[model samples]
Target: MALRPNPTLRQRRLGSELRRMREQAGLGGSELARRLGIGPAQMTQMEQARIGVSPERLRMVASACGCSNEPLIDALARMTSERGKGWWEEYRGVLTVDFLEVAELEAHAERITFCTTAYIPGLLQTPAYASAVFARLFPPLPPREIETRTEFRIRRQELIRSGGTPLHTFIHEAALRMQFGGPSVLLDQLRALLDDSERPGISVRIVPFAVDTFPGAGENLTFANGPVAELDTVEVDVSQGALFLESPTDLANHRAIFSRLDATALAEKESRDFIRSIMKEVESSNA
Candidate 1:
């Protein structure tokens, strides 16, 4: 097969995990290639995600690496077996890769947790608010680009609306009051948030300004729980774009940060009340 020019994050992660398995078994690429009856370069391509790995090949590699963790090996095999194209692929060339990868990550996530300080989480954003947020980009995007991004974002929210995956989001009071599109837009957004908070599989909590301490240094992050803990991933929103984190250390740290934010935020019922209060304020201000 021809080598992939730009492998998706999931593809790269599979390669990384394969490499990790080899390293843990203290085997060099050449040695593994010899054992697997393939050329060293072929092994390198597989490990680099430039080429695909069949389930049989993946199991063979796991056996060679002395990896007895059946659950992990099964998960890897499933990853290798996935052949369906995701909905995000439709926007592949039109939007940035980060957007597509983020959607992919959420689609595969068994559970998702989001923490934000300044802006509403994408999975919970209204179309008007998302369009407004995109409109204010530093290097302003063209009108067409803004519309595309807003549409993509609204599409992403389908994962939440499906209620198949559990979602827990922590938003700071500051984000609730940002008025991205305008007071009217933010009001609609907040009301939508309130409605979503009551959903069976969704949890929305607010971190009030009255809180004595806040964590995560005010960063916006999404932690996606994988089928297995080792497969978990985190996406941090930065000025450049979405940064995906998967190393054991990065996963642990972000998980801890989410825990801290969870503890600091108000309970679900209280958060709903808080949002209602904010809606009233927005209405009064507009009046």
Candidate 2:
């Protein structure tokens, strides 16, 4: 098959897993390629995610590399076996790869946990709220681009809404009060938050300003739990854009940081009360 000029994050992730397994087994790409009866370049291409690997080839490579973790292998195989294009394909030309990656990751993730400080988690945002945030783009997106992106955000929410994957989000109190679009928009957003919180498969927790400390406060993070710990991925939102981290060390660090955040944040019940009080605060101010 011809190589994809641009590989999605999931594809790149599969390649990373293969590379890790090969390294763990202390086998070089050339040696492995020889064992598998393929060209060295073909092995490199698969590992670089420039080319897709068939499910049969995936198992062959895993077995050849002596990758013993059955769960990881199965998960990787499943990723490869996923046929047909996903909904994100429709936005291929309109949005950058990173934006599409977020949707793809969320779509397949077993579970999603987001710690958002500056803004509401995208999945939980209302159309008006999301549109307002997009409209404020500094460089200013073309009108059509803004509309497209906002629509994409709304559609992405369907992953969780469909009850296919569970989502737990930790949000700071500041975000609940930001009033991104103005009082009317903010009011509706807070109500939407309350509504989403009540939905099955969705959990929302708040970290009050009164809390003594907030760890990993500056960096926005979402841990998209895969089928197993080995396949787990962490996303860090930076100024340049989203950064995907899957190395053992990066995963461990992010896991610990989120554990702490989850521990310090309000309990789900208290979080509801906190959100309600904040709603009242906003109401009084607007009055």
Candidate 3:
């Protein structure tokens, strides 16, 4: 099979896990290749996600490498079986690869937890709010490009609306007051957020400014929980782009951060009331 020049994040993650399994078993690449009756180059390709691995082949690798993590193995096998292009594929070339990766992560996530300090979470933003955000890009994107990006972001919310995956989001008080598209837009966004919070599988919490201490140093983060804890991934939004974290250490640290945020955030009923208060403040200011 032809090696893939550009593998998706999921593919690369699978490859990385295979490599991890081998390393944990203290086996060298060549040695494993010999045991599997495959060439060293083939092993390299499989580990780099350039070539696909069948479920049967994956199990063979696990057996050969002495990996006893049954749940992880089963999840990896499921990933190997997944085929066909996702909805994000349509925007493959139009948007940056990071955008597609984010969607894919959310699509496969068993649960999602995210925190935003200055801006509303993308999955919860209203169309106008999203457009205003894109319009303020540093170099400034073309009007058409802004529309494209906004459309892409809105489409990402489909997973949330579908109720297929549960989402718990933490939004700092600053985000609710930013008024991205001015008071009118912010009001609509907050109202939409409240409505979304009432959804069956979605939970929204607000971290008030009154909190004595904040975690994550105000960084925007999205944690996508996988089928197995080891497969979980964290996406940190930075000015350069989204950075994905998957190492055991990174995952553990982020999980801790989220735990702290959860502790500091308001309860669901309180958060709803707080949003209502913010909406009133916006309405009063606009009037």
- TM-scores, each model vs. reference: 0.97, 0.96, 0.98
The reply for model 2, stretches above 4 Å from the true place, is: none
- Winning candidate number (lDDT): 3
lDDT values for all models: 0.92, 0.91, 0.94
Candidate 1 residue lDDT tens string, 88-160: 9999899999999999999999999998988888888899999999998888899999999999999998988
lDDT of 3 by residue, 101-186 (tens): 99999999999998999899999999999999998887989999999999999999999999999999999999999977788888
lDDT tens digits by residue: candidate 2, 202-274: 9999998998999888877999999999888899898787898999999999999999998899998899999
Number of the top candidate by TM-score? 3
What overall lDDT, based on C-alpha atoms, would model 1 receive against the true structure?
0.92
The residue-level lDDT of candidate 1 at 132 comes to 94
- Candidate 1 ranges with C-alpha deviation above 4 Å: none
